[model samples]
Target chain A: TQLLEQSPQFLSIQEGENLTVYCNSSSVFSSLQWYRQEPGEGPVLLVTVVTGGEVKKLKRLTFQFGDARKDSSLHITAAQPGDTGLYLCAGGPHKTGANSKLTFGKGITLSVRP
Target chain B: EAGVAQSPRYKIIEKRQSVAFWCNPISGHATLYWYQQILGQGPKLLIQFQNNGVVDDSQLPKDRFSAERLKGVDSTLKIQPAKLEDSAVYLCASNRLRDARSEYFGPGTRLTVL
Candidate 1:
């Protein structure tokens, strides 16, 4: 089973439009992170939310950690073509050392038309 | 500072051919990871290393896959007699600390089985 599930597998929008992606999980996480990837490139870290009920803003992107610490969301305002790529949300490891593994969502692919 | 480095940005091989990918993490980083990403899917952790020790490799297919990090700074993932199902992008990522929430990733090596 997928530890984290992402909604809206694909999204296409105009350059000026806005959108939100969701990542949900059944277990608690010490921290959650969002990343973006371009074609033929690895993912780049965008933000990390460690506290439940915490919200962080990075330019046009806003990230939120759920009150229960089991979910997270990414909201992009005035999305640009540069934002077009695969957006992934990953859950932090449950244990220390070897178990410090990351579990990722299926990811949401966003395409912004120029 | 330099980012994570991966080799053979693209690889095309026939089924049953052996393949190997290399990764060099950022200097001073103690945590390293190898992930496999299939088309249209998020990355899945194949193995992890902490200072030249195996942190996690439970998801790794030991029958055909093996990875090693001798000095904790560089790693290599090898697949012997690769199968068609093994085609995907192999990503290497690292973080400054062992339990850091943020991870830096490389451009990844895209593999295709003909």
Candidate 2:
């Protein structure tokens, strides 16, 4: 079973619309990260939330870490065609060393039409 | 700075054939990772390397898969007697350090085994 679960396996919307993708897990994590991958390319880091209850914004994209550190969410405002891609969530468990392994969610494919 | 570099952006092979993929991480990055991404799913970590030493490879199929990093720099992943189920995108990623929040990824090599 996947350690992290992402909802809305696929989403297609028109430009200027808003959307939210979620990542949920039963186990608490030390940190959570979100990435975006375009077709035929590798994923690109969008944001990382290390502390629970923390929220970060990157222009049109907003990321939040759950208070319990077991979940996270990504919200896109006024979506643009450029935002079209697959979104993935990854988490790191609490560990002593820096060499921690990451668990990934299945991901959500977002297609924004212009 | 250059992002992670991968070779042979695409490869097609028949079952039981062997193939290899190469990666060169960003300069000064000490942590390298190889991920396998099947269609409609997130990328899964296959192995991780710290410099030229292995740190994690629990998910790698040792019988048919082998990887090595030489001189703490470039790395290679090989699959022998490839299986049809092994068809996926082989992604190479790098981080400045193990604890670093973001990992830079290459375009990835798409492998199709028939």
| Tens-digit lDDT string for candidate 1 (A32-63) | 99999999999999998999999999999999
Candidate 1 lDDT tens digits, B10-104: 99999999999999999999999999999989999999898899978889999999999997788999999899999899999998887888789
Q: How big is the RMSD of model 1?
A: 1.3
In candidate 2, residue A17 scores what lDDT?
A: 100
| Candidate 2 per-residue lDDT over residues B1-112, each given as its tens digit | 9999999899999999999999999999999999999999999999999999999999999999999998999999999989999999999999988877678899999999
Worst 10-residue lDDT window, candidate 1 chain A:
A93-102
Clashing pairs in 1: none
Model 1 bad stretches (over 4 Å): A95-98
Task: Give model 2's share of reference contacts.
Answer: 0.83
